[model samples]
Target: MISEEEQKKEGKNEKLLADLCECCIMLHVGFQVSPKKVTSVGVHHLLKVVLKKEESEETQEEVERAFLALKNIAMWVKIDKELHLSEIKEIIKYHQKHRNLTHLAYQYAWEFLIHRFYSNESLEIIIVNELHFGKEAARKLEELRKNVDWTRKEDERGKETKEVLVITGWMKTIKSYFDSCKLWNEEYVELIGSVVQIYRTAKDNYEEIRYWCVFSLRNAAGNGFVPVDDLLKSGAVGCVLEDIRKPTLIDEITHHSLTFFENISRRLKEKTYNEMEEAKRKELKRKVLEKIEEEGYEEIIISLHERLNTLKRKYFYGDELSLNISDYSVNI
Candidate 1:
């Protein structure tokens, strides 16, 4: 099936992409040596690599490598960030439209690559809006939901490490979008139920996946645009409270859980309960709990106050609870 001319062309293109990756490595060193030595031309070459429409594994390999190289450059490059992000949006847009035209834009690897760009401050308004981050996030979460076998318990998942690769990667991808949420719309609100569902499903079986989902919730809860009403309707609070009650909870997960409660309470305080419609007020009270039960969730919250009185206190509580809950009793 192979012709000599085609074989030679393949070999040449493969070598070029390999050279591009090596050049990017050197660019990293060049930045380390003297930031001045890293010229705009290096970036121009890297950016142009993503535009390569060739469908070979070699091309995909170079695209992923180029993204890694761009992420490093983004950290220290003393250039206009908007210009960088603008070019990225264009490249992403191209792949977005063309990947469906029987091409490989690195498949799911693009999710990994896009998250690197999210660390930039421009994610708040520019790329997220243009790329439909929230909508895409919902779709990805739904795919994870359908593909994963939530009924299987952890120990029973023997020979299922392959399934885990799907879940862990997709969950990480979904969480990355929550890094810097500013603008909110119906698409963002649509995410509440799906996130809660995934957390509940993974709570018992997959610790790593559970942490990713909960941490994503924590990040979303931390922001000003958090839809308090949507969260209430979605049972997000109950899922988090369940996690907090876990006897095996680790310090980092505990810290994130506590922060979730803290941020939710702060956001709740900002709302005028007396002025809200009866439906919303009742929903908030019901979701957090009944009048006495409300105080109970608030009690857990009050415990958080004493528990997190200082950074040391918080760490000690989480550590002590995790380590000594059976050997000795502890209080928040």
Candidate 2:
């Protein structure tokens, strides 16, 4: 019963959809085969088409297809060995301009950037300029934190949980850049302070959030990036120590806390007496020991030592208990 003109219009629309799908498939194959050979022209053309869809009133199905295409292209570019920096910048630029995109689309764009350019110095500059260290990112984080209510059980499908997931994903991506090779610098102090504040305020039941905080702390503490004194001042060390001491702590949480402790202790141990004047070295060592004792590490170590001794005796003596405990206890 359709008119000829109406049928022609429908045919045109179907062809357009088919063409977009074909383009997406072709690009996916091209990138996988030879990413370096995939020129900007094809990418830009696809992006233009996608952006056009974004600006126009499109069907949800059409929009989703476009997003999928973009995500595939992004994944391809991310894995490319040649480092398509300009392509990454283009994606970020699109994200910055279209801040109203759906969470899934935005996450795709952000993931592309995080994977493609995290260790690149350009990322730091991009973060400072586009993300606005304190104003934009910090404000968003604080807003998300406030939205979460710790008194009630969290709904996995609720808005609060989704927001927390986004924040945690961002934290995990940022944590990777703070590894030993990178380290924390003075410029990042405010951002690091924000992370520490989040860690201190997060509820114990919110293990995902707490886990990333400790993960970031572990990286920040490594390679002597942040001085021991500064770390102590941030109260992160105390927070981690307290968490590890909890009777209900899980292995995953305990592992991260202990790793952070190990990083700090290993850094301190590297500063030999010959590296500094005797007075300064002794004072530094004394301060470290005092902090350890204050954090109850001394008791933990003593308990571990005693447990090891008991295990050694049981393993060696069977039930005899006659073997000299001194032989194993001396080294311990």
Candidate 3:
């Protein structure tokens, strides 16, 4: 029942949408290679045009292309040091309005923003305004942790398993953001309590969840963002040492814990202990040394050294050379 002219117009629109999608794909690839150069005035203008198109005016293909373009632009802001505040705001608005309908689009858009503005304030805004990471998130995680029966297989939980998977994925994303930007500030310091609580709750729940907790803790504790005193007070160090001693713990967890310990130890060793008052210096050194000794670090290091010697003996034929003198036929 459609007229020939209307059919031709629809066909043209589809073709145009396809072309735009192709252009976006190319731009994304180019941005990956050299974002600073690709995000020039011309490209920025074209992206803005694409972004301005309303959902009603855009075909599904066009909408996807626009989102892709926005994501690339957002990523470019990270390396270029260019402030695309207006464009970023537009992407956020579009994502907020359309996230439920297209989750992946919103996800890439959200990540782009996170990477673009690598600061504690920006992260807090994303957490509170965009991701809503507060009491509700805490409540949901707590509820999921309560419902999870780790005695049974993860697959047996059905709906709860799905929820746990989603929550853990979100945790990993947040952890990655924290890892990428080492924001040492009061804002991040405040997050230590919530992070530690999540860590303790998720320790026995899922392997991936626990790994992320340790990874995030390592990054947070690195660069002195969360002070050693604070971490020790939170019992985070004890938890990490316990995890390291777990017979079934994954290598990733062990590696991150070791790195965390090394960072803390480096910080402690760098302290101006000699410059401090004698009593204070001795007290601080005593506390640190006592913690290290209580954690069985001396035994752990000795064991590692013995294991290394055993490996050397096994592989290097230590102090025992085996040569085929008969085949060599006397070198002289």
Q: List the residue pairs that clash in candidate 1.
A: none
| Per-model TM-score versus the true fold | 0.67, 0.61, 0.55
Q: What lDDT score is found at residue 297 in candidate 2?
A: 73
What lDDT score is found at residue 35 in candidate 1? 44
lDDT of 2 by residue, 42-109 (tens): 34434444443244335333443554455555554544434444654565566556654544444445
Reference-based lDDT, residue 289, model 1: 45
What is the C-alpha lDDT profile of model 3 across 64-151, one tens digit per residue? Answer: 5555565555544443334555565566566555643233344444555565555334555545554443333344445555666655
- Scored against the true structure, residue 126 in model 2 reaches a CA lDDT of 62
User: Model 3 reaches what TM-score against the true structure?
Assistant: 0.55
Instruction: Say which candidate scores most in TM-score.
Output: 1
Candidate 1 segments whose C-alpha is farther than 4 A from its true place: 1-31, 35-39, 75-79, 84-87, 98-123, 144-179, 271-287, 290-332
lDDT of each: 0.58, 0.53, 0.52
Residue-wise C-alpha lDDT for candidate 1, range 1-332, written one tens digit per residue? 11222246444454454355436545565424344434354455566666576767777777766655655555455545454556666666676666521112232434534454555556556545777766655665676577767778556866455445555655565556565556777777767677787788778777777887787787777676667666665666666777877767666787777666666665654545465564565466455544325435544545444444453355542222222121111111
Cα displacement (angstroms), candidate 3, residue 98, comes to: 13
